[model samples]
Target chain A: MTLVTVDDVRGAATRIASDVIRTPLLPCARLSDELGLRVLIKPESLQNTGSFKVRGALNTLLTWKENGTLPEGVVGFSAGNHAAAVAFAGQRLGVKAIIAMPHDAVESKVINVRRYGGEIVPTDDLLGTTEELASRYGYPPLLPFNLPEVIAGQGTVGLEIAEDAPEAAAVIVPVGGGGLISGIGAAVTALAPSMRVIGVEPEISNALSLAMTHGEVRELPRAERTIADGLAAPRAGNHTLENALAYVDEMAVVSENAIGEAWADLADSAKLIVEPAAAVGLAALRTGAVSLPAGCTVVLVVSGGNADLVKLAQARMG
Target chain B: MTLVTVDDVRGAATRIASDVIRTPLLPCARLSDELGLRVLIKPESLQNTGSFKVRGALNTLLTWKENGTLPEGVVGFSAGNHAAAVAFAGQRLGVKAIIAMPHDAVESKVINVRRYGGEIVPTDDLLGTTEELASRYGYPPLLPFNLPEVIAGQGTVGLEIAEDAPEAAAVIVPVGGGGLISGIGAAVTALAPSMRVIGVEPEISNALSLAMTHGEVRELPRAERTIADGLAAPRAGNHTLENALAYVDEMAVVSENAIGEAWADLADSAKLIVEPAAAVGLAALRTGAVSLPAGCTVVLVVSGGNADLVKLAQARMG
Candidate 1:
């Protein structure tokens, strides 16, 4: 099995350097004081397209373009962030993109995908629609998380974290379909072998956590309602599970209420307005679900900020 | 009259390089497309203490520390951002600080000021109370916007803007007591003479605008209500007026409604959660209060993000 190596991530960094933001690793003074640990946040929420997904999407598209196998059009399915990323990458690379987003995805996310010149196909079954569209038009499918190239691209974030916070004792990342963490886990283990890589997921969608516990990929019986819609993936991919089993240190699950509270706390204390998905790592820490030794440095990867303003407003009110 | 020079701003940049954030200059894709102009945003909202005020405060404190005249304590009065800056600077410099904020200032600002180890003194007359306390304790008063050192420090933002967006044809900045614009106006004029430096003010608190119109320092009859609480200063300072007269090309006023709308739009499209005060420059553009030639590049200085989450949530709901 050829897995994503640190060298692959390094290549991805070089490939996507011009396309992605080298997001700042900011010190969370308020959170640090509260946690008695040096708390730093990698605000990927500030990345172009408002998520780290852009890194993977751009790298994949760039690779395709370089190989001269770039299709006339690309198709992808996403809850939101990945769709916008594919759209943005497609626009920049001059490739037509068709994004199949969940019918209930956030309006802003849908709007942004379209704003980037990607045709949006709202569907109840996003995966089925994307596959159908890809087959019908003979367009290449840009997988959101499972592909090795995508994972390698996302691992560039871990390279940044390792460089920016070399003394980091623990790095907390929110897990969705597990691409982000799998990449980060591989990179951090290779570069900063002593540091622990922790993955956080909403309690309602603990696919990665359950997979780790069972020592195999596991699927949820059904999709569960979660405030962190970004982390609502039903199962972890085989590649992600294999990587996580080898490199990831631990997994934590946070309640929906905790995710909402963490979202608001991040907004108030850190002055960062991020989606519930992005706040899950912070939620794990805030709710005491994940604990680090005193005086240790922890880096929380704030995954994205593409949240509905109305919902965020309602969350703040609540 | 001696004014802040580009040299002074360069020195400030060097002095505060380790203390303040070298905030990113991001492109506003949607706004630029809307106006058919290249629109960039200098997100000082992402600076230390969530505002550009930290640059000035850190520079002042560093100067004081170097001169060996650093007071045992510092005192300052501000609606919010400046107070937080002073408090953060004081804490970093090992100087005790007492900050007097308006009794009705945003709770988050008050809490942040306190969090930085500054003693908070809530008062109806913040200026009077700050002055009284400073005199009583022999603590030096760190004026929010009138000090030469502060303005010179804030000028560093202009240096960054000039460097990052060298092609910028116009720069729009929000003005309160006018220190920010005065500094930016001076720096931009020196560094990029062809760039038009424009100041934006809320219609209800158009102190700088009125001062510019009268060709002298002027005071508003009363501070009128506006969503941009950060720009609610009743008058422009003498030093700021002098600098503005020398350097600023034009002043614009934005309605309260427009400020609120711009604030929401920034959150939605740019994924940046900033105060209405920070949104005023964008508001000026959005409302057609300030117009630039087609295809010209415009840089908007987003001054701060220390807004009440409750109010922001409410604004998003509306």
Candidate 2:
């Protein structure tokens, strides 16, 4: 099997350079001063489609376009960002796009998906069950979580960290179906083996952690709650599981309230509107669930900022 | 007084290169597709202090330190960002800082100021009345509005813009005390005189607009009521006014609701948490307050992201 490597990430960086926004690596003096660790943030929140999902989605779409697999149209089922990503990528490639989103998806996300020229189909199926909609779209689904090219594309983030802060001891990534962590885990291990790669998950939806413990893919009960809808994966992907088992060092879980609190802290204190999944790394660090090595340079990959507006308002009100 | 030029910005870029984050310039394809104009954003929201205030503050404090102004310490009065900036600047310069904020200042800003080693002096003096507190602090007050060096320091933004997007047809900036606009205006005009320099102000605290029409600084009574507290300058500083008058091509005012909506749009669409002041530029463009030349490139300088968490929550909720 041809697997993703550092060279693929470098190629992705080159291919996506003009299209993707190389979101900055910011020094978190406030977080650092508080944690006594050198903290830096790779803010994927500023990426196109308001999330890092765009990186993998765009990369996959572009690769398909290059490989002639991009047919008359493309489709996807996503909570928000991934749908937006497919729409954006399709729009960029001048291909038709149909995005199936849960009926309960945020109004803002719905608007953005439409804004990017995607045909939005509302699903009556319960929230968090997206695979069925993907299969029904009449086109190959754009899987943000499970593809090799997508994972290789997302791994460019780790490539950036290694280039920018070589001394970083650990890179913490928020995991969902484990796409982000799997990509980053492999990249960091290959490029900077001394750097530890930790995956953070919302406790209610710690599918990756469960998989790690079980040493196999475990399907958790549905209806798990998390403010980080992006990270609320019900099960781990086989590809992502293999990557995690091979390269990822550890998995840590943070609570629902903790996720909300971290989200609020990111917005209020850090001046970022990160989704709950993106905040997990900070949540893990803040809550002392992970005792970082002393004086270690730590990098937290803030996954995305396309949070539900109403939920954000609710979180703020609470 | 010695003023900062594009050369100074180049020098600052090198000096702060090792310290400050090189913020990304994002092309808004969605906005670009909607409008005939090509829109680019300098996301200073990702700055070290989560605001562009750090640029000027860093330059000024460092200049003072190099010139031997480290005798006692530094002082400032602000509702949010400037306080943190001064504190950050002082800390970097290895000096003591006393930041006086109003009683109603946002909690996150207060915490950030404190976290940056600033000694906060809470004052009952209502918004726009910080002189007394500054006098009490003994340390010379670093007024956000009045300082020439601050404006000159902020001029560095324009330098970056000219270097990064030299073909830009217009540069829009959020205006508060006019320091940012003043500096940015000067740099933009000097670097690319053909580019239209525009200033955006919250309708509530449009001191510079009133000053422009009247040919003198005029304090507006309603400046205290806006959600964009950062841009709520009661009076325009003479130095800032001079620069704005000389360099700015147009000034537009955005409503409070527009600011809130812009904030929400940024969070939802752009995945950034820009404060009301920073949102003003986008608000003006979104609301069609700022007319663009057809097919021209427009650059919006998002000045900061140090939003008040509680206020953000309220905005999100309401």
Candidate 3:
């Protein structure tokens, strides 16, 4: 397997520059002061689809178009940000999108995908089966993970961090199907060999962490219920698992309550509206899951902001 | 008073370069398609203080320091974002900040100010009187309006729009004490005189519109009930009133329900969490209180994101 290189990541950056927002790298003074280390945040929550999913989705679709491999249309199955990202990517790239969503996906996200001109097919039941939904789509399926181009595309985020903050001692990212972490880890390990890469996951869905421990892609029988719905993947992707195992320095899991508290903490302090998944890195740090070496600068990737308003309201009320 | 020149506003752009986020002027294709006119949004709701208030506040305080007139410390009376702005501004400038807030201010906002390293003093009553609170702390209040430097500072937002979208035919701004409008109007009028400068206000607390008709700042016997607490100014300031009369092309008022709907509309469509005051401009457009000129390009200045979570929850539930 040819691991994606820094050059490919840089190409992805150039290709997606116009469409995606090169979100800010803000200095978190309070967090820095508290941790006794310099802390910088990649505000990917501000991205077009409210997540970094847009980067990989767009890059993959754009690459397919440029290479003459894109089909008549694209199809994907996702309950949240990836669906929206695929829809947005299709719209911007002039490709039609057919998205399969779980019956119980948040109405806001469903509406957003439709608003962006994607056709949605909702499953009657969401009992952990998406293969049937993909098969029913008739055309082709676009798995968010298990895509080589998607992994290479997402590595650009880490490529950016390495370029923007070369002195960064570590980079932290929330793991879902391990696509984001795999891509980021590849870039960091390639560009800055000394910079450590850390993966954060919800305690309920520590699939990648468990996989890393077991030396292969492992499926958890039960999906972890987490407010950070974006990061609660039940299984790890083969390609991503290989990448994570090779490059990622450490992995940590955070509880749902800690994720909620981190979301509130950012909203209250940084005046940012980020989803629970995006806050998991900070949550892990706050819970002392990962300790920062003194004066070492760390970059936390805030994954997205396509939050469920009802869920947020409930958290705030509680 | 020497009116703010294009040059001064340009200087402000340079001065706040490293400090402020150069927020995107996002195009609203759907909103534009609905209106039969082009619509662009300047989303200051994503600003550091969750409002454009910080632009003016920081600019005013920085300009004061540059001119050698700033005191050892600064203070302000605000419901929330402004308090947080003064806190952020003070922290950046290395000064202590004391914010005077009404007892009934949103807990979310009160917590934000203190989280940003500002001291908060909750008042004994929820009434409009704040002079005693300001004096008790021995802090010269940072007025949102009635301050030339602040108005000039806020005008930088308009300057950005004028620079970014020279073809924009009209600019919409939400009015409170009118500092935002004052700044926007001055900058837009000077930079893009052909562009109309429209001001929007919540119908219940439209002090600027009423003051325009009456030719003076008049206090309402009872404050109007509205979800847009940020725009619930009891009375207009003399300077704000004068600037509105001279620079604002037109003023329109929207109902409380309209404001709430606008907030929800943006959230549902744009996946953005905006405060009610920021929605007031869009509310006016939706309610037919403001009309776009034929085939014109309109810029709606989204001023803040300091929404009270409780109010948002109620709105969502309804």
Candidate 4:
């Protein structure tokens, strides 16, 4: 199977360089001191659309434009981050973005997509709705994960982690559909082969872990939702699963309570406003869901920061 | 008429090198794009104990310890940030920190000081209570700002900013007791003399601006308080005033409304959980209180992030 190459990621980096922010890695000194491990945070929450989704989205569109196959519009389905990303990127490239979103999507997510001039189609069947819309309008389907271009785009994050924290013993990444980790895995495994690529998922949303164990895609019920809405991908795409199986070294699942606690801790201690999905990697380490040896340095991909301020406040109060 | 010298700042940098965070400058792409001016953020909010005050507190204590004049106990007065800093720093040095804080101090700030093993003396008169406690207990007073040692320590931040973003057109800092900006002004004037040093204060708590205008210290009534509690210094101490007069180039005062709006915007746009005091520099730029030429780069010191989460949630809701 053809997988996302590090060269593809290098190409994507050049393509989306102007479209995306070169997010800095903030050292979590407080957490590092407590854990006796160097904790580096690549805070993509401070990214253009407040998530790493922008990299994949922008790369997918920009690649098409560069290859002279740019479509008039794109259709995709996501719980949140990917939707906003496609909307923002499509608008930037003068391509329309139509997102088939869940009825219970986060208000901010919906707002962000609209703010970027993306049209939303409310749907109970996210993937089906997106496919139908794409087919009907002859628009290209912008897969949130699983596609080679998307995976290659997301791999840019891995290239950055490898470049920024070459001494990192492991890079812990949040796995939704496995697009981010697969791309990162490919890059890190090739460039910083010494560093392990660890994937983390919410305990309930363990599609990536289940897929790796069964050596196949395993879909969860749509009703089984997680507070980390951005990480609600029920199954990994074939491309992403293949890349993960080939490149990811380990997988860990964190509890909902731990995710909540870590989310609050990250804000209070690191002064970072991160969403629940973004906090899961830190949660994995904090709760020993993904334990590393003491004194080992680990890089955590803080995927996004589209957090609800009200919820953050309530968490702090608790 | 001696002020915080560049050499003094250099010494403080060496003395407290390990004690504080070497805060990185985050390039604000969104704000820069919106205003057509390059904006960089020096987020000291992620410092140890979540404020730049730790630099001064640690430096003051470390300087004495280095000189072999270390005392058994230290006393100080503050609304919040300094109290926590001294508490954390004193505990590190095996010195007892007794902080006389206002009765209406933020609960989180109070909790942090106690968590760091400091004794709190509740008082109506912050300085008077602290002085009385220090004199009665025969302990050396740890002034929050204005002393040569403390100014030198805070000047370390200026040194970092100058070194990190040497091309900055101006470094906008929040002025409370004038220790932070005065130290920074001294360093920036000496090192990056081409770069401007702009001090920002809440309109209601404009002690630094007032002192600079009147050519002497003028104390405001303690009852008049702004939401930027960390910047509620009634007046500057003599040393800070002298330093400001010698080194500071410009001053800006922001409205209470602008402060609140900027506090929320920093979280929403930048994903930085900063306090109201830390927001005033951005507030000044946003409210057109400190406009600069288009395309010129400016650095804003995000001084602290020890904000009340519940209040933040409430603000978001509003």
Candidate 5:
């Protein structure tokens, strides 16, 4: 098994530096004052393509290009941010991309993918359709989080946190398909071994937590509906499970109501409008589901900022 | 008359560099593709205090501190962002700040000002009450926009724009009491003489546009109601009018509907939830109220991001 190392994340940072934004790590003064812990927010929602997905997508494309094995086209399945990222990276790297998405995917995400010159193939079975298309067209399939290059790319987020907040005692990350947390856990453990790395997920879609309890990657009994559509991964990837088991310190889950309340707090106090998935970390912290020592410096990795306007409004109202 | 100079802006930049955020100059890829113009956005809404107001507020405080004229207490009048800026600056500089605000101001803004340690004095007449309290308590009043030092502080935004996009053909700025545009005009003209500086305002509050046409400062016949509460200044300041005439290229007015649509576009495409006043520049561009030559690089200064959640939802729905 190929594992993501600190050197891989560092190399990925150097490789993707020109294409990706080194998003700001801002101090949330009000939240810090209220919580008695210094809070720093890494807003990846402001990253190119509006999420951290671009880091992995671009890194994957770059690796293929550098090895001269670049395919004529790429195929992927995603509900939103990853689709857009793959499409955007494909366009930038002169590769054609066809993305398979659920028919009920968010309208804005569909538009964004198309805007980046990706051909969208809507299907009821997103993963099955995407795999079939890859085989039929002889195109490479870019799994969102189950690949080594992608996880290494995502781990750069932890490298940044370690560099930006070396004093942080705990780092909170929202888990979706377990890619982000696995990568972050690997990087943070390697760089700041004493710092606690915690993963947060929606209560309904606790794939990572379930996998952790079972000591292996496992699919949930049934798919669950969640406002955080990004975190609704039915199963955790095997590669990600390995990294999580080796590096992650703990896992926490938050309710839909807590997510909405955290979203509102971010919008009002931090003046940021992140998606429901991105608020899971804040939700975990706010609901006391994850606790740390008092006055400890804490970092929240805000994963993305893509949400339907109506849903965001509703979250804020709640 | 002591006019603002490029030197003053450079000095202000150095003075406030440590305390203020050097906000990102992000490329709006979707807007660039759709408009056929290279669109760059400076999201000042992400700045400290959630607006560009902190630049001027901190500069004012620093200037006083340097000259040994810094008072133990400061007074100011503002409806929103400026109040928060003043309070934050006061707390940082170890000075007591008391701000008089209209009772009907946005609840979030009120909460933010109080969060920054500013004592809020509710009043029916913001300016009159603030002046009365300043005189009665022998506290120096920090004017929001009219003073030379304030205008000089605001000029730092233009300096950043010129440095970031020296090839920009035109820059769009939202106009309130006109301090921002005036400062930007001075900086851009001095740095990039060929770049055009355009000012935008709500149609009902076209004080600067009217002042430009009349060749002097002028107050509107009556206060007009607009969703862009920040741009509801009754009149343009005299110092700002002088700068506008000397450096500004033109002024444009956008309707309330245009503002709402632009706000929605920003939320969806740009992933930024800015105030209605901040959206005026985008509104002008979307509605073609302010026409720029195609293929030219354009910069839009997004001024602030303070809004009521319900109102933001309504705007997005529209």
Candidate 6:
């Protein structure tokens, strides 16, 4: 398996520069005081489509257009943010997008995909339905995370962090299908080799953590449902796993309760509204699942903010 | 009243440059599309102390230090943000801060004040209690919005906006005691005279709106308590009113429901977590209380993000 390179990540950054926000690196003063480590928040939650998925989606679609292979339409499968991003990119480029979402995908995410004008098909078999649609309708498939192009796209986050928070000793990212952290791992490990890259997942959705332990990607039995819905990918992308093996330094898993507590704390103290999946890195750090030394500056990538208000309210109630 | 000038704002910007985040101006793709106008977001909610009050607080104390008149301690009355900011500024500058906060101030905000090392005195009469403390202890009063230094500091936001979103035709700011808008009015009006300055207040805390109608600073009987706790000031400072009359182009009052709706929409679409006071600017625009021409570019200042999660949950349940 060919791992993605920093140059490819740089290219994606140039390609998608105009489309995505150079989301800020905010100083987490409260957390810094509490943890005795300087914590900087790299909030990709503020990115276009409210997630880092926009970077990859835009990069892939923009690459296709650049190659003059832009299809009339595309079909993709995602739990949420990626599908919405694909839809948004399709709309931006005047291409049709049909997305297959999990039958039980969060309502806000489904709404987000539809808001971008992506035709949504609910299915229990997310990948199978998307594949069938692509084959039947003659639309090109934009597989979410498995592609090198997507990996390269997401690596831009690392490039930005390297530029914006160079003082950071480590970069922690949320891992779902490992698309985000894979790209971040590839970029950061190549460019800032001294800075360790850590991936965080909910204990229930610890695919990347388990893969790191076993030295290979294995499809595990579906884990119990997690509040961190975005990290529930039971298996990592094949390309992502390869990239992870090459670049990622460590992985950690935090409990559902920790994730929930982190989510609320982030909003209350940090004034950051982030989705449950995006809160896992903070959860890991705050819960002692991934402890760093005092004075160690860490950059926590808040990967998305497409949070459901209802879920946010429920968290408050608890 | 001696109104603040753009140069004063510039000096404040330089003075507090290292102490605060130069918060980014975010592109609101969804809001821009829905409004058929370019809507950029200036999220001071991401500022130090999670509000723009830090700029004013930092500037006020910094100026005192620069002039060799730095006091032994400072007394201030605020709903929350300003008090917390004063506490933060005092901690940074090695001065004591005693804050008079409303008994009904949001719990999170109260926590913020305490966290910043400010000694809090809960009071029904915020200003009177603060004044009494200042007189008794010889701790100079750091009034929230009336001071030229504080207004000048907040005006730095306008300086950044003028530089960052030069295309904007209008700037919508949330008004409490008019300190923020007064400062912004001073900067934007001086730096970009063609741009209209609009102030938005909740109907329950329409001090500036009523002041504009009356052409003077007038204390209205206490209105109904607003969900926008930060914008619940019943009167504007005399200096702030004078600046508003001179530099502010218009004032609008929005219903509490509109503020709540706008807060949720900001979280949902723009992925911005803002307090209800901050949401009123968007609420005014969304509710047609401050309508702009189609294709007009407008900048909305999300003034702070010290939101109560319980309130957020309640908004979601609605």
Place model 2 in a CAPRI quality band. medium
Per-residue CA lDDT of model 4 for A1-318, tens digit only, reads: 798889999999999999788887888767897778988889888888789999999999988898899999999998888999999999899999999999998887888788788999998999789889989999989999988989999999999999989999999999999999999998999999999999999999988888889889988765667878889898887898899989999999998888888888888877888899988988988888888989999998999988888888777666
- Candidate order by DockQ, decreasing, is 4, 6, 2, 5, 1, 3
Candidate 2 local lDDT, B116-195, one digit each (tens):
88988788663434566546656676777677677766777787887789899999998888888777776777788888
In the range B19-105, model 3's lDDT, one tens digit per residue, is 777776766555766678777878786677677877777887888889998766776888788888889888888888877787888
What lDDT score is found at residue B155 in candidate 2?
76
Candidates 2 and 3, the one with greater lDDT: 3
Q: Considering only chain A, what is the TM-score of each predicted structure? A: 0.97, 0.93, 0.93, 0.97, 0.97, 0.97
Candidate number with the higher TM-score (4 or 5): 4
| Model 4: DockQ score | 0.69
Model 3 Cα lDDT, one tens digit per residue, A1-318: 666666777888888888876665767655776778888888776667677888888888888888998766778877778888889898897878888777777776787688778888787443223455445645456678667678877888898898889889999999888988888887889889888899998888888888889888887876546777787666887888888888899999988889898886665444456777888888888899988889899998988777766667666666
User: Mind giving the per-residue lDDT tens digits that candidate 1 earns over B12-35?
Assistant: 899999887777677766677787
| Residue A218 accuracy (lDDT) in model 6 | 76
lDDT of 4 by residue, B71-162 (tens): 99999999889999999899889999999999999988998898789999999898789889989998999998979989999999999999
Alpha-carbon interface RMSD for all candidates, in angstroms: 2.4, 2.8, 3.6, 1.5, 2.0, 1.8
Cα TM-score of candidate 6? 0.95
Q: State every prediction's TM-score relative to the real structure.
A: 0.91, 0.88, 0.86, 0.96, 0.90, 0.95
Give candidate 3 misplaced runs (Cα > 4 Å): A13-19, A26-40, A90-100, A116-138, A159-169, A187-195, A293-297, B7-41, B59-75, B87-100, B116-130, B133-139, B162-167, B192-195, B220-223, B293-298
The residue ranges of model 6 lying beyond 4 angstroms of the native Cα positions read none
> Which lDDT tens digits does candidate 6 get at residues A107-205?
888988989999999999987898899998999889778889999999999999988877689999999788888899888887788899998888877
Q: Best candidate per lDDT, number?
A: 4
Q: Specify the CAPRI tier of model 1.
A: acceptable
TM-score of chain B taken alone, candidate 4: 0.98
DockQ of each: 0.44, 0.51, 0.26, 0.69, 0.51, 0.65
lDDT over C-alpha atoms for residue B76 of model 6:
94
Q: In candidate 4, residue A221 scores what lDDT?
A: 63
Please report how far candidate 6 places residue A302 from its true position, in Å.
0.8
Candidate 2, DockQ score (0 to 1):
0.51
